[model samples]
Target: MTVALMWEARAVAGRGGELLAWARARELPRVPLRRETFRAPQDRVLVITWWDAPYDADLPELPEPDPELVTRAVHRWRFEAVDGD
Candidate 1:
């Protein structure tokens, strides 16, 4: 089964672009099947990575960037594929 991981962060005011760039430059220790990035209002950045492992399998994840670049700590979520999707 496939699994997906979501990572998110909120940048400090007026630093959304910098935060996005930082995210784009990251190189995870374990590459994912697919990865995507998104931007939202309020300087938020979200990244989703799809992996071939099972939902409960141990996987390597990217660590948060410098604390000075963000307003709050990063957030993460995990989801398993449903109906073989």
Candidate 2:
């Protein structure tokens, strides 16, 4: 079965640009990954990534950031596919 995964993360105060760049650079080796980012009115940023793969396999791991500089973010999701529609 094919699976879709969604993840959302918020960056610390002024690190959104840096984190987004890191995400972009890190995905260079993967064949099929989709990602998007948006900035809130308060200046917080959100990133979401989607990919197609088998359910049993692990999703691509994001690079860990410096512990002192950023807060560990949040991830949310739903998994679904059309019935061969």
TM-score result, candidate 1:
0.93
The whole-model C-alpha lDDT of candidate 1 against the native structure comes to 0.92
- The weakest ten consecutive residues by lDDT in model 2 span 41-50
Question: Candidate 1 on 1-85: residue-level lDDT in tens?
Answer: 8999999999999999999999988998988999999999999999999999978999777688799999999999999988766
Cα deviation at 76, candidate 2, in Å, is 5.9
Off by over 4 Å in 2: 33-49, 73-78, 83-85
- Tally clashing residue pairs in candidate 1: 0
Query: Total clashes, candidate 2?
Result: 0
Every candidate's lDDT: 0.92, 0.56
Displacement of the residue 3 alpha carbon in candidate 2, Å: 2.0
Best by TM-score: 1
